[model samples]
Target: MQNNKKVIVGISGGVDSSVCALMLKSAGFDVQGVFMKNWTNSAPNIECTTEKDFADAEAVCDQIGIPLHQANFSGDYWDRVFKKFLSDHNEGLTPNPDILCNKEIKFRAFLDYCLEIGADYIATGHYVRVDNSGSSARLLRGIDPTKDQSYFLHQVTGKDLAKSLFPLGELTKEQVRQIAKDNKLITAGKKDSVGICFIGKNKYNDFIANFLGKDPGAILDEEGNELGVHDGLMYFTLGQRQGIGLGGIKGKEQDSWYVAHKDTQSKALTVVQGRDHPLLFSDGCYVEDVQWVNENNQEELNCEVQIRYQSQPVKAQLKKLTNGYKIIFASPQLAVTPGQSAVIYQGDDCLGGSVIKDRISSDFYSWADNRGYNYQVYG
Candidate 1:
């Protein structure tokens, strides 16, 4: 009954992970609960809830009659995940810290620690399934489409996949919550954590300002007309329609405005009139730091790529580059922001993904080509 195999489940003091521990214990595995303390630094306007999470994790472990292990990965997280997150934003790119956390913290640090303690494998409540029937493990989208987390996990290496488990992969959010409720787990009704990894419920603007103070700049229109002033260029991202703080500008329509692009050279945030503005769509994109999962190391292949989590996968042609790959979308993609992951997949198989380095917009391409503008310079 696999009772001899020790499985260390990372308990995050949430319903999903709480239920994950319950399911693993019920399955007769030698289950142990581990609470990863990845963030401990104090920041103004940001609440550090590690103590509360630790207590909840402890209560769950006690209820399950399993020993709970705790480790401080704050140093490793700062070095590997938090630094890169700040660096990406500093470079005017919107980075996904969750992707880095999964790779560096949960899968790398936590996995290594568990293995060192004689655990056969480490599991999380990530809603993604792994297929080990083949010679190499394959990552698949969770059965619950609404909650599938494979996009964030595409950076995980093949070797790590083999030693990982996802007990809630086949269960929906409702099912996991129901299981927790049935077991009377303290986290049965706890809301899922969102926003920055480990820094709970912190406002993005305040968090960024606390770490890296604002570099205020002008908000401009597509034609280079200044509409208003912004706190910083790094504070906004592509496709953002809110927080522009501009209204009733003369000569401009009352329609909603969205962030179309950023001119880092001039320190300007460009705005378009509407959500479907041509500047928001891209025909293709350039990706960097790709990691393949199924050993598909081909130079080029046809696949579907997801630009962000919860987005529908779009058909694309993958052209391998020395450092990354060129993703030419069959159809124009919306809001393909730099530094966010471009996860490639063929059906349900998560081939791999990389950071979106650049994108080719037909509107921008033509506008630049006719004017003989250099793409590199414009980028």
Candidate 2:
């Protein structure tokens, strides 16, 4: 690789990105490390570890003999990612802020910033590969099936994918750590960060309640019988078993409860006793804001769809809609929550994805309506 193009690698102070910087430098490219502070712990009691991460990033850059750059995208994150996350939860939906952060902050804001400083490409530690061998770039699943992240990156355009590099795409977790260890990078054995991106580890409910204030509500059974009281609807999600503050009910076989539905009109949460409750499963979902990485990819066809991260892809039939698309799964999916993304894939290539606006199941919707619980209009 004989090139003098400048590449800005987004280092997250983790083993994957550390190896990214090392590999790019070894490949004879002009490499620099950029730490994007997309979130700050400005809120009372919210922990912010960006400073520590920056220090780790600085250490890796020093070891790699490259310059380190800093950029704070908290403003963009708040407006684009955080606000929508809160809004979705408040409206009885589960939103994946990480997906939005990748599209808005990492690729958009961070990419632009890197380009402004004369970068030819922006790279990250994401476990997804980009195929620029074609006329237009294509996003493919990482060689590591257990860690492929193409689902989260479905919304990124082909143009952006062309200019981005994923140095860790072909390597597994173990390989990444080994490379980092060989190079004596500080993050070689560092534990991976979890929870929301940029937002340090904290109690999820407490963090969310701080923004969407607790609106206490009643927990009801499938028949609308009052079971118990909940702190807030925002704290719950479909198929959630913990934190319900409920116990085994009479004549219910002493089984645990799961959140089946949320009646936003009456501020009532419906619970059922079984883990695989019928109400929790849906045949398909209506999606909005659909974006295709390559427009030439199939618009409507049979493919595999994934509704959440760490979920297994299932066979599905996708049909085009005026505003978006509808995915009809071969089998019912559990907890197909709105506000989360439904990404489409054909074999290993990620076609694209969109936000889940509403889940479609005639039986469930009709049952709720008959019981006087109102769900959003089915698309």
Candidate 3:
């Protein structure tokens, strides 16, 4: 049992965090709950749940008999996260801001704030574990495989992991909910939040349009044939299969269309006939801004990689480059998207990750070159 070591618990007015604080307090640690206000104001038509969320957090703190605190990191979030989100989208790549928030806010800024406030460590509701008994701290996948969030936390370093606690790592979502119910926590019945946190329960395109105005452009097929006019390239992502205003084509109506490429320079969206289209698959991709949670990352290693959160990890080989790393899959993977984190894992321990730059396969290059597209595929 922790002997009254002061720790700050980041409560999000959710069952997971509320349970996190309760479990810590039960363990005899001096626990305090702090609600981080990430998004301060929202555009018109978008619902801002900050006030409601804060009240819920206060209720849970009261129920647990712990003092609650609040921190406004909205300015930090806007400068560090939201701007980058808009920049990536404007460049036709869909970036996950949650990953950025975890790196910059929860673990970086929030951790700093907690440490400055005299807390020994900061805890959160993240569904991942950290093994600090090692030579250096190591991040492990949560016991609950279905709710594991290690993929979204690849940017956190070992130094930060050593000072962090994940109370819900050993518990599944159902187990957490049941524990909350048994304790009569206020958040036990609250629904889990989904999608982008800032734009809660609002139309995605509508929220983005407030920042990035619409720029209508021609949507082209793989063969460079104009198909339709797109609202904007920022609204589409790699492997997107719907909401393209597409209808039954003459003979290809039976086959579904998928976004194969987004040409930001030409302001055109390239689509393909079927999910199995050759353009949608790539042998590997070049990743930039690679971050290694483990201090001693090998120059070359064979490991499993997950390109997106929901996708399963597949066999891959990582080779160090002068600037970044090139990840080659055992087999061609579909929709190797840019601006998405490609997290590396050796067994259940998260090694680290980098943003997918672009496809390095010859097929992708040949297709883009043959179409007279002008974009640097490599440095």
The candidate scoring highest on TM-score is: 3
lDDT of 3 by residue, 1-379 (tens): 8856999999999888999999999998999999999996766677788888889999999999899999999999999999999999988888999999999999999999999999999999989999998778899999999889999899999999999999899999999999999999989999998888898888888899989999889989878888899989999888889887889877565788899888888899999988988889989888985788977568888999999996889999999888888999999888999999899999999999999988766777898889998655554
**Ordering by lDDT:** 3, 2, 1
Q: Of models 1 and 2, which has the larger lDDT?
A: 2
RMSD of each: 1.9, 1.5, 1.3
Query: Where in model 3 is the C-alpha error above 4 Å?
Result: 375-379
lDDT of each: 0.86, 0.87, 0.90
Model 2 compared with the native: what TM-score? 0.96
lDDT of 1 by residue, 1-379 (tens): 7899999999887778888888889999999988888886677667777778888889888888888988889899999999898898888899999999998889898899999999999999999999999888999999999999999999888789999999888999999988988889889988888867665777787777888897889888887788889988789998898888889889989889999877677788878897788988999898885888756758888999999999999999998776677889999988989989999999999989988888878797775465344455121
Task: Name the regions of candidate 1 deviating beyond 4 angstroms.
Answer: 368-374, 377-379
Clashing pairs in 2: none
Tell how far residue 252 is off in model 2, in angstroms.
Answer: 2.8
Q: TM-score-based ranking, best first?
A: 3, 2, 1
Go through the candidates in order and give the clash count of each.
Answer: 0, 0, 0
**Local distance difference test, candidate 2:** 0.87
